[model samples]
Target: MSTGQTRSDRKPAPVKMVTTDTGRILRISPEDESARAAVAAAATPAPQNIDPARRTDVLFRVRRAEGHELSSWWMVGAFVVTSGLVIALLSWVPYSA
Candidate 1:
């Protein structure tokens, strides 16, 4: 007895709604793949600049640790011993500079 298409029998269309600050409702029903792709691409995040204060703080921390001197005699001794071993290793190699 029913002559019209029922809601259960019909395929639903894509509904996208965006609201503006001026009380405007934008209802967009994109009909093509290119329009959907354009919307998707536009929504992607672009790169932003580093905060100057944060960057300066990081740079300051790096430079703050730089000028502090360490009297590391033990480390120097270990390095000299390692260098001697490397020199000895190089002596075993034929025609090495």
Candidate 2:
């Protein structure tokens, strides 16, 4: 009764428009064979239904260290000799000069 405006004449509320894809156009169809193959290949492989009795928890390696065994033996011998000499000197009481 105040302005005499009809319902059809009322303007719609403005919407805050936003594009998630950065306004770039892309053409893709589900019927494309390449897209289907890519989706399948990128998916994780399904778990196999194997017998639990045949399962193994052990892992084996055939690799060897690059260092020589001779060097290790030399290090052990040196440590033993040095320790023995230190013990002998500490155990010996000096006869005062």
Candidate 3:
């Protein structure tokens, strides 16, 4: 799944291809105004202005139980009850005469 901008979406920038002595080709973007602006925009961090009330609301919604959904405590209690019943049944069974 692509989450951000794709290469095909952006216009291809003019680049200089230089061959090194080690037979390696390097594609370098020109240090122009547009290139500098693009670099600056990419380097800039996104603003994060989170409201405490909004955060609490989101957290509450996440923790809120829906209909037919069992809580962790209920599941644990059921497991403990089933285990006790199994143990009691096994103890009552006579293995030897």
What are the TM-scores, per candidate, against the unseen true structure? Answer: 0.27, 0.24, 0.28
TM-score of candidate 2 relative to the true fold: 0.24
lDDT tens per residue, model 2, 34-88: 7646755666653467433333542442334466235588889999999999888
TM-score of 1: 0.27
lDDT of 3 by residue, 1-97 (tens): 9889656767778887754333347566776657555544655443367443345435543433367555689889999999999888888889932
- Candidate 1 per-residue lDDT, tens place, 1-97, comes to 9989666966678878764333347566766556656655666443366443355335543322456755589789999999999999999999997
Q: Could you arrange the candidates by TM-score from highest to lowest?
A: 3, 1, 2
| Candidate number of the best lDDT | 1
List of clashing residue pairs for candidate 3: none
In model 1, where do residues sit more than 4 Å from their true spots? 1-71
Number of backbone-clashing residue pairs for each candidate, in the order shown: 0, 0, 0
Clashing pairs in 2: none
How much is the lDDT of residue 3 in candidate 3?
82
Off by over 4 Å in 2: 1-70, 94-97
